[model samples]
Target chain A: MTEAIQKTVQPIGVATAALETKRLSAWFGDLHVVKDISLTVEKNDVFSLIGPSGCGKSTFIRCLNRLHEETDGARVRGEVLIPGAGKRENIYAQGVDPVSIRRRVGMVFQKPNPFPGLSIFDNVAAGLKLAGVVRRNVLEEIVEISLVQAALWDEVKDKLKKPGTSLSGGQQQRLCIARALAVRPQVLLMDEPTSALDPISTARIEELVMKLRSDVTVLIVTHNMQQAARISNQTAFFLMGELVEVGPTKSIFTKPKDSRTEQYITGRFG
Target chain B: MIELSSRDGVRKFSNYFWLAMLCLLAFTAIAPLFFIFAYLLVRGWAGLSFAFFTEIPKPVGEVGGGMANAITGSLVLMGLSTVFGVPLGLACGMALSELKKSAIAKMLRISIDLLTSVPSIVIGLFAYALVVVPMRGYSAWAGGFALSIVMVPIVARSTEEILKLVPASIHEAGLALGLPRWKVLIRLILPGVRAGVTTGILLALARVSGETAPLLFTAFSNSFGYRGLSAPTASLPVQIYTYATSHDETWRQLAWTGALVLVFVVFCLNLVTRILTRRTV
Candidate 1:
């Protein structure tokens, strides 16, 4: 696994980046949240976004999958490009359906919201089932693989029929990850996924994210600097609705080019 | 330990005093309902029999008869009204909730709220004009349509309020899964709020069960049960009204029994709603 990942890790021109954003900005009515931001997310990478409260880190990633516009009066003005059916296409282009965009770019919210009234197995199979996958054996196979991939198969295998909310806090978050993974998304975007959990659960999620680099590109937004340093290969620091700095995790933390990034990282001010 | 002063003593006295007051007010509010229920049970019990559920109402001089036809009519009207009312109400509620700030949604909200307060008799007249007049005859379909008018505003308003109570995150979760807005509302939002939605529906059903004014003009009271949706129907409320107002002793007694039956059916509907909405976990 290490050798295979090493073979593909090298930046091959523009092909390695799974997602690219150009001059992307978002607003909720008149309150601008995500200012013009441009960035690239490499494939098979764990990219982390870190910032203080109200920095638009969450809103920034939400725009990647076209979810930000779901907010009332929210508008997006920029371009998000992702590899489409054949070539990379701008997601924000007119006539593009946001539903199809979301199908390929799955998201995990900060709170672990498993579909209420759905059993664990059903929750995992929800994406495929809603998209018109009807075969029972196929759903079962995918559900098992997703649960296994999320590292939750051993704990939840016996209770696939139980409600997804019946699991522990940490387990529910992992189940959501499993749910997002079931569709085999090209990119997975997480927004503060571990902020609400205990320390142990947070550690488990961080570990799971690291292991996930072999399968899906993970773009995670977090409040914990340690979590960002631990899980992310690339880190972007957001401040006051703008991208302050983004670089390799080591360089950004050790010697940030921007003063605000340095201050925010060094725990001086946010 | 703190010392017990006159202030402490007064605090204890006021606490008991308020608790007693609240209890008294609560009992005052609820005691009349139970008393009325008991009165109905005592008065109506003697007239109730197997015949009341299986036979149609007889003429004034008849010694023994029942209101089976009226009971069946009520059921049919409820069925038809539900078919007409529920989907429209749910769709309207979902739309209003989703696009709450839109001009059309605001207009719809005001119209529905006004409709809820409109007299049932006026709605009866509406059904009389819209259905009975157009068809050139009073029929069960008209009655059902009338009841559905009464039902729509109640169901729609309640459904909107219930859907709004669901956290925004739940809806967002479904959308994040790549489901369309309608699909999210169907597979996720609606299912999560099923208990609330069912309660709203049952509320409408209970109201329809005892509706008299609308059915009086639209259904026009058949001697026997309706043969088809196109024919005039006998309903429980109209039968009760007719019997209760009649000078004959037997008809008056039958009215009490019909009233009892309507209340019992409504009670059962609420019980079923509770059972259906009970938490599975």
Candidate 2:
């Protein structure tokens, strides 16, 4: 058990990299959605990915957790490295389990998808329970902590027994966040998680994303440039399945190195 | 405005004419069902009595008897058929839904479709040849095996369609949580569609219980008591057929009440299935 835990843990002295990609590319059948792109997210950085519709930012993050290949006729070719056996291991390696990688790298989708059949408490504990953590007391404690981390604890703590879907749209999204956090992921991926919510709800999520940085590295894809400017410390610009520019969020907004990045961010053209 | 006004009168007349015609046609479609209900209620009301629920069949030409054995036999056959059919049908459906474009699924789909269209009587013959001849007796085992053949296709098809109705996104959510494929299915997917799958099983049961031709040769008919799964067993449909065709007036009357009871059971099953499906939606 200790060996297993040590294997998943990173070496103490190596420079911390929560997520890194090496020439990662993906395709849905013959249509390439994400081109070869190498990038790194420092541990605890709120990294934002900004792009136009169908620009492949969503597909890129999906590949990070190996979720892209789950689609019918979809395929990925790349290297995604996270902690494995006391070092950063390429997740796409032949023997690596995608499901195991996903547990370590949690995701919150664009639309809030709380398991409708479960209560709020069960929704947060689903990952833990599925991972073989079954004791009620252990589940209760982890659920409360995760909910508090997602900033949804106070609102839902009293009604943890209510169906997860009964919550308001924003609350539902936060519930999903809490669910993702319960498993203690080292990196969290948000695939335009606020696009389906109202401005106020979006504001709450943006705030939560910033606060989440204390524990996990965050990679967020968003159509809203202002959201990236407000919440993210670093930003990567993508266009036509390729990364155009990446830098500090302030610089990416104030002065982009690529002409397309300037045009797209400046509202000249997408 | 000119274009809209030019055809307004003609369009209005066409719309009203088709609407009225369709309403009449729709009523025509449903009229026979109400007529059947009224006819059965009137004809079968006299045959019902306290004895009908509590007593076993009194021998032929006798009065004041019940089809208690047949009722219990029908329940047994339904239970046996459900045991034999539901798990296999559910497994078939899961395979069909998961392997959408596979060659194996295509073949399985075609086979199930063909099985559904096969006459129930032919299924009885199949069970007769497969079980009756081998076992050298008509028994509840043969009857249930035959009825299960009639059930598998319905359950499999409905389960496939119902499982499909659950959006792919919900399934993906489970997978994203790092749950294994089977865990996601049992914990997330199946529970989400529990009512719907139950509706399919109930529908299959309704059809199975009402089956007359399939049980004719497979289960034969008994008047006294259920022997065992390996013994000839009585059933409501077979009993009704025998009573209806008998020379005795009292037997015919008993047949009407037996049919009424069977009809009520099927109607209740259908009603429950409807409610369950509504909950699923």
Candidate 3:
């Protein structure tokens, strides 16, 4: 673990960071999964968290949305602040509504869960409808635009009425992306979004992620190191529930500042 | 040397033996249903007639009327029961699945299970005492209330089980969209489990359509047709009981026809539910 400290992190401009965690630590039962970790994600930038399984990467992402509400002895001592649409707002305050934060910050799971019961059109419009959009024509337009933006319009435009589960694996993942985008969330958190897909499907999603970075800030947790190098502007490396190092993607790969990051990157100790 | 005691051989034999036993059990269980159906048709078919459907039952020795009033009575009572029962059952099921942490949800589930286990006769007595005694007379409404009591538990249990079967991943996806809990349940979870809930409701309807015990004290018996909910009603099972025990063979024949009609309606309900589910699946 000591080798993790020397991993090199590229110095990037601080203005890009949109959300920052001061000193976040999360626990499940007696097990401390995420131990005093802090990281920053820039607005309209892609930040990839790469680590081995059971390294607290997934747990860390779940905490951001309060999905695994730290109600059962699960506590976060540090501050997680996201710049408000106008003014600064403390996201980690006790009085803050998790639902409101969740609206601005959305999540996509590892599998291609496309709400099997709903049609493709409804799948995209689900978030909007939930936020109380009732007009049919407007919903129709958002559905079309979201599907198009997710790069899934051409394939499913004809069968918008079909069940979302009818699509192929790659298209289903893209549909999930479209569903997430429909609500117009500012930040998107993806947990191993392509881990369940085939190589070709993975590539298409990878391409979509790159395209999405221009509009929404993306914080992804992935096991694929190469994927981090290819898509993310910044990369954070974790090992044994601790963030070993974080830096620009290129610097993290070529000259890691931490030895643990270096060992893990070189396939020495995952 | 022969290797009869090998692990692979032992595993193979045991697997095949279990499979054969399972198949035999399945066949044994299904065979009785066919036998019962055949028996009913044989005895009940001879009673079929227009008068059997349109007329009331006769007295001790005379044979002139049928079970027409009972048939309509059964339909009206079941319809009323369904109108009262289905929505409440579905709502309770939705609440149990979507609101796992609420105290009301837990209590609702417990009550539903308790209601289901309550004997049919007890339900009849309860309804008779509460509804019939209150009105100072037996009425179709009392019977419908009893039937709805039975229907609610069955529908609620089925709905809960079916909603539980819907993948949590689906709910998570909806929640990820920032949808409130109720919207997630109504729009996403409910639709996913719709087929199973419908099947359960049909099964409940089938149960109520033929029930005689609960309605005995509630709806009582009216040889003539009822006008609506407030009046005494005729139902197939209660009327069948009334006719089959009489000395008149004509009344007995009419009773058989009523029985046959009840069976046909239940069978059709089951068939439609199956076909609907199949199409959706």
Best by TM-score: 2
Clashes counted in candidate 3 amount to: 10
Ranking by DockQ: 1, 2, 3
List of clashing residue pairs for candidate 3: A3-A259, A3-A260, A4-A260, A6-A257, A6-A258, A7-A256, A7-A257, A7-A258, A8-A256, A8-A257
State how far residue A88 of model 1 sits from its true place (Å): 1.9
Report the alpha-carbon TM-score of model 3 versus the true structure.
0.89
Task: State the C-alpha lDDT per candidate.
Answer: 0.90, 0.90, 0.84
lDDT tens digits by residue: candidate 3, B1-281: 25755877889999999999999999999999888788789888887777787777666677577777898899888998999899999888888877666788788888888998999999999999999999988888999999999999999888888888787778777777776667888887787666788898998999899899999899988877877788889899998898788767777777777777888999999898888668555
Evaluate chain B of model 1: give its TM-score. Answer: 0.92
Docking class of 2: medium
DockQ of 2: 0.57
List CA RMSD, all candidates. Answer: 4.7, 4.8, 4.7
Q: Candidate 1, DockQ to 2 decimals?
A: 0.62
Cα misplacement distance, residue B231 of candidate 1 (Å): 1.7
Give a tens-digit lDDT track for model 1, residues A1-270: 999897557446367779988899999899999999988888888999999999999999999989989987899999998888778899999999999889889999999989887899989998899899999999999999999999999999999999898999999999999999998899999999999999999999999999999999999999999999998999999999999999999999999999899999999986
- Spell out the clash pairs found in candidate 1: none
Docking class of 3: medium
lDDT tens per residue, model 2, A96-136? 89899889989999999888678899889999998899899
The alpha-carbon deviation from the true structure for residue A79 of candidate 3, after best TM-score superposition, in angstroms, is: 2.9
Candidate 3 C-alpha lDDT tens digits along A159-180: 9999998999889999999998
Task: Give the true-contact fraction for every prediction, in order.
Answer: 0.57, 0.50, 0.53
